[model samples]
Target: MSLTSNKSSSVLSYLESVSTSDLISDPASIGLTIRELLRRFGGASETTSLTLQDLELAFGKSIALGFSLWQHMAALDRLSAIPDWLANNAPRVANLRNGSAICGLATTHLSSPVTIHGSPSPNGYVVSGTARWVSGFNFFDNLILGFETSDAYCFALIPFPQPIIPIGSSPDSIRCDFRLLDLTALQSTSTGELTLENFPVLNTQLLSRREKNARPAPRKSSLKIPELGVAKSVSKKINSALAAKQTHPLSTDFASALAQINSRITQLEAERCDDSLDLAGPCHLLIQDTLRLFALLSGSRSLAAGSEASRLTLEAMLFDVFLQSENSMRLKIEAAAR
Candidate 1:
């Protein structure tokens, strides 16, 4: 059966009850949340006898993470892959299934794309690359990194503090430590820089690689739940502030816009479950509008430090550069020019 509004609301309500302190830590609360969430929907794996409907509900549960950005982003690394990634890689699934986080380090800034390379070796391959701004992933012991081989790009599942075996003096390889960066936003996420130098990814560890001369999948950074959360929470705050002035045209207009955005989200989600439709593109615009509305209507409260409005203001800017698409960035640049 499809998840109803009541069931979805129940899951969101559970997220609201979970405190920030409970969600971000070693053995992250997000994992616990996912584990608990799985109970209601069979589980998040294909091996577990989960029906197609059950699997859909399990994926839907992640939308609740939007309520807590800390949990949402931290959990995104592992949750986004779910049963498919997990079921395919059974060898590592034992550790991963036990609340472990598997971070994907594919996001790259226009100026600094993934510079890592993997070359063929007698045994498997030798990987050396630099993946930047890898947040939330550091908390876990496992990481799924992408590197460009001589012919194509490939993904490898590597354990943290990876070891290098001596092979007739291949030069003693040194694995580096993760350094948490103090970003303007998502500072709470423990965002860090990952520098991998001559790291070894055994053939057993290599997950999937892009085929030589094959077309790459379209890149669409879909982050609907968090955007929806921002809209829902910020709008509620605005609604409350204007409770006495409900009939005011501005308040009415804000309410109308929020409804329209919500309706759009539902329609789009019903269309597909994946990030293929440039979901972030539309959601980003709606979120930007909500942020502007909050700033304009919330008045002095928006300026206060540590306030939701202030935090969201930074977050609004975060989505653009945070795993944003080239097309979206180009559109933003064009809009600025106009």
Candidate 2:
């Protein structure tokens, strides 16, 4: 469903009032903002069920908040698919649905080749390995992680360690050592590396397990939505700046590039393209071009630490590494070479 103009305006105003620097220094603030947005707009269901256009509208205002919300929504969507898991964890589900408890995603391994293995134990399971990139560190209470065993791939919902023990001190017990990364952009995401050693997973928390070879393929549409959303936001900003300076020499070039990008977005949305790998390259290039033009158009002001252009530029660059797989990277590289 589309977000009404009044609702959009309210969201925009609230997002605008948030300090980017404050968010960077204290990433947990993003969770609070997300909770407020969920409450204002129809709670968890509304967030999970948001259309691409709705997401684009939100992303246009603030990428950090938008990405965080998307991640939370995605985790909820995955968890809710398992009937037994939902029935067993009703109270936790209630907290998650109402925004009282935030959930983080650690399922990148399902798509990529990262190895997080789970072994059966008497009471439940023991998971051990590294989750290369887990976002929403301080903000999330639970994490839904995907791991593989000898013959099965499993998903589990577990509580994130509170007052995590020092790395070397915890040998026998379940240990999750979180190392927050120094990110150039999306710092407010609180992305980090989690090294799990003998992590305990209770029976109640085990969501699902399927044959290793039967792991579901990633949905191309869901994979490309965020990129398209952010690209549209960049395109709109660049187009607006060009409109204001009709006499600028580069206006024609900028207009042409944005036209192609906008057309690509339209085609993908209308056709629901399945070639997300192919879509990635062009979308990334278009966003880079638009952000570059935006910076150029803004002149010296865009170089400031607090500039909108600067923030968007960095956020756009984050797509290069954020949620990227090897195949997507090759396509992006090939596209750049062209």
Candidate 3:
């Protein structure tokens, strides 16, 4: 659906107060529509035998669409120009859409404590503390917060507020900042620190419970597995479509390369599931295969600048960069080995 004539006005009207029902109810549809829209704007999807890729591509697509829509609004001179801070954060968000190959993997297993200290007597999680480099925080309605309680990490789903304190904006004692160096292309989605003094958290606002040193929930894991299928379908379709349009002799090579990568990745996945091979190694292999596909699809054209095709290639490049982090690779490896 098209936004209102006064897009900025409409967006504000749309988001002024979000009910949990409005925000969480249609996450799946919202994400899909976003993926299609971004695909129109030169984004591609890839899959690994991992769930975070699905979550990233899906949710990340919506956020990217929202941001793109915002840019359109700004271009129409409907919304005021984005502030410098917001502009600075756009690269991070865009990369998030491309990095669907590894979204949510970073924070899925942990929870943080938020101390809220404002308004009606502990009515909600009065978050005086800040979340650093929160991707799409401006649009996220609820955040799964974690805190240490009785020597355990307890997680709760809390509503996120606007006017967020972005990482690298400025340093503050009560603010949480994401570490930027850890992220590759998603410059904005870094994992930062949160600091709060006497922040109040209420019982009702809590989202989930993380028992100290407890393994991740199996239900969540199972749910994520299916989501990866969506990305796999999308990537396979795009690569095959690109393969079919080939007029050059080299096009077959590209097809062969993509097919080879996909074949190897699938074999690795099978081994991972059968407990015959370590997941850590396969996860690394997945990243490598994804990068290889990106290279094949973009070819020498990926190096050019100032053209529409170049922009598309750049998005994929940034995506691979974001996925290539050593720490992230390590986590996937560890999770797989487990």
Candidate 4:
């Protein structure tokens, strides 16, 4: 179902009921909020542009929660590509839908030099290497990991907490360790470094396997939704501040910039184009500009820890690194240099 105006307002109201500080201090609270949302709004399959627009609305309320929800929904989207797996895992899918189980994506290795190699085994494959960044550590019950083998790139769903090995399996069959990273922002996400040594992935858990050099699937514009949400949130705050002090020297300039950025975001959303490369740099640049404007408007108050301005500034910095691709990185550099 589409996330109608009433549903978006409902989500915002529910988020408003909890203080941001309290939500950040307790990651489980974010999980509960997601569960409540799933129970009310339905599952990832139901996530449309309106659903994402609701998340964009969420960014103004809580960045951490918005980011976490995006991660969950993205994971669901990836899983949907593997129809055979979904057909066989009905109960697991139900748990995911109902929020009885939470899943995180660990596919940054696909773009990074860090390699999680999978060696073929009788059961499936043994994966060993470090997955550089995995959010939702303590809160996730499963992880969808991407790894490289000799001939292909593979995706697999592995149980978190390291499931027990089957009888007759070697003692070192499955070993996984999680090290929580101390992040400057989004600490509530519990992002961490995941180390896997001789971790076995059963055949049933295997999702998609593609040739290492195979052409990637068409890009989706939905990927930009979260970033747009963040940009919109920053713009709204700046506009609110400008409204309060209409005579401020930079008010008109900032207003114009916000209008242009909002117009661009709306245009992109309406097009729903499959060209992320063309969108990434402009989106990042707009967000960066709005963040700086907000900081300027807040003055010294934005520098203070736990301040909303400070929180958003740091969160925007974190997004700069989130799912960075070589092309996106180059585009951002080009945009910044302009």
Candidate 5:
């Protein structure tokens, strides 16, 4: 099926309104996709264990990279509990789902060890540090900053649209400055370089884990549905474009790629409920290959600096990032990259 057929008018309208220039400044377009998916997913709960099929249905229903971010966080909400010792008492921290906060873990620029120091204070810990690789901040209401401290991976939830903390003594509010950077893709995501100077984090905002640091007897990897969903949408668009130009020799390759994506989606749908970890690997490989073929079949047309195809090519390269650190799936992404 052509990507056009898979999308509704509203989705198309939103996509059409964005140009390369628009993406260059902000990619908040993804918020629309996220909002639609949340509504369709019926607002996930701590118990909602979403599979690839659910993501496919949601992606096929709408579209976005935020979908994976939302899905992963939702899954974390469902699967992992904020350790009682490290848990914050803020009501908003527990309600992060309502704002669809962007997880800043492993973001590219911050991929180089990043940490926010916690200065002990009477009210809470005053965290002050700069963090980059932040996306969807313009739309997402909070920043899920994951940092490497002394021993373990520490994560925190900071409310968005934060007020600036004064330079000298502790002030009434914490402030963050944004220096948006230009990127190859997902520019519309509103990604930026964040500078935090004495940003206050209440104890209730700290996200703690209660893991014993041991291997599981039955380990299995879960799929990053949002990544796959973005890949799915891009693949359909490539399919539609290829279908329109049947006379092109690359059409055959396009057909083959589309078939492979479909096959992978079908397999994921059937096997996701099982305990085996084999499903996400092949699915990512398929999406990776699908993006490559999209660039190939689209050829010179895709070379345009701000084209959607170009953005997707960059997104495909970044597919491996932003996932949980201990996740075994990252290894597969590494292998696929190789």
Candidate 6:
């Protein structure tokens, strides 16, 4: 279901009928939007390039719509693009056995089934292993998990609403419990690990390759970093507000440092182009340093456990800042070294 197709005109109208006010707090509404997005844009050419500008616009608009309805104005500016839609559709996908958003960069390992043997079934191949760190898995009615095969990263979708394949849970994987993280940041988004012993994946569930193009498909960083960038900008604004009345040398220094790093970040962002790993390398590094600085600045108040500043530190530390920066940094380093 190509979202950019004429069929999307009606879908878009249906989506428009959904009051923007209802989308913010309503996980269901968010889920619907995600489904629409996938239906519209999911299976682009594997080697197609992404429109960074479009991504940024989609992200900002989604955030604005969600925040306006929920009155979470603080977070409104943190959205870089359509990640909210991507994450939102997880639950819905758990209901729809046919569709899955397997198009992205972080999913390169999906050359084969998650397990070595790839579960066998009398009818077709049944993949009975869990794919770790599957974001938006909760909403997916079926899952198209990627695995490292002998040849390529093969991806397959497994039907859902089935019994769980029990296994011991690990830190890096998704747990079957569906327990939301008690994370102060991204509390609204549900993420966890899965433990699959033999989660059945039928042969018909495999993701088919589309037309090859000049560029590779978008990756997780493509989905996450822009959002993180928005989040970082928001955090800076919040910190400025918090430090407005209270004067401290550390606060001033942090502000100055943040400004300086952000300036570099801005330059790098401007220079970033499609698949140009060299230009993106410095941007990723800048994000890492900026995150560290933000973390340090946010934790500055936590110098003492009992101090009034401790709470401030918690409020200041935006998780998106560190997580995306680290991921981006690794990519940059890898690209540079390569």
Minimum summed lDDT over a 10-residue window in model 4 is located at: 41-50
Q: Per-residue lDDT of 164-251 in model 1, one digit per residue for the tens? A: 3445544546455566766555554455677666667788776566776887654443333344555555556666766766776688
Better of 4 and 5 by TM-score: 4
Global fold similarity of model 4 (TM-score): 0.87
Among residues 3 or more apart in sequence or in different chains, the pairs in candidate 1 whose N, CA or C atoms overlap within 3 Å are: 116-129
Per lDDT, the best of the predicted structures is 4
If scored against the real structure, what TM-score would every candidate get?
0.72, 0.85, 0.46, 0.87, 0.63, 0.48
* Model 2 score (lDDT): 0.72
Q: What is the lDDT of residue 222 in candidate 4?
A: 48
Q: lDDT order of candidates, best first?
A: 4, 2, 1, 5, 6, 3
Candidate scoring better on TM-score of 3 and 6: 6
Error of 5 at 71 (Å): 7.5
lDDT of 3: 0.38
Between candidates 2 and 6, name the one with more favorable lDDT: 2
Name the lDDT value of residue 16 in candidate 2. 72
| Candidate 6 per-residue lDDT over residues 1-338, each given as its tens digit | 46334443443455456654444334455555555543454323322222333343333334422211121111111122235433554453332211233211113243333442243456544333443443333343434454443333445544432334345665333223333444342332333344444444455555532222334455433432343243344345546754773675577677777677767756656555444444434544554465456556556563665332332234223322333334555775586697
Q: List the residue pairs that clash in candidate 4.
A: none
* Per-residue lDDT of 338 in model 5: 86
* lDDT, candidate 4, 1-338, per-residue tens: 54387788777777778678855667787777777777666443434222666667666667777878877767777777677888888788877876778788887347646468898999999888887778887677888899989988888887764423345657565667778888867788888878887887888788888897798786454455566777777777777888998988887877887788778768766655655336655666667777887888888999998888888877776657774556668878777698
Candidate 2, poorest ten consecutive residues by summed lDDT: 42-51
Instruction: Please write out the lDDT profile of model 3 over residues 32-107, one tens digit for every residue.
Output: 3333333433233212121323333332222223322222222212111224423454553344333321122112
Clashing pairs in 2: none
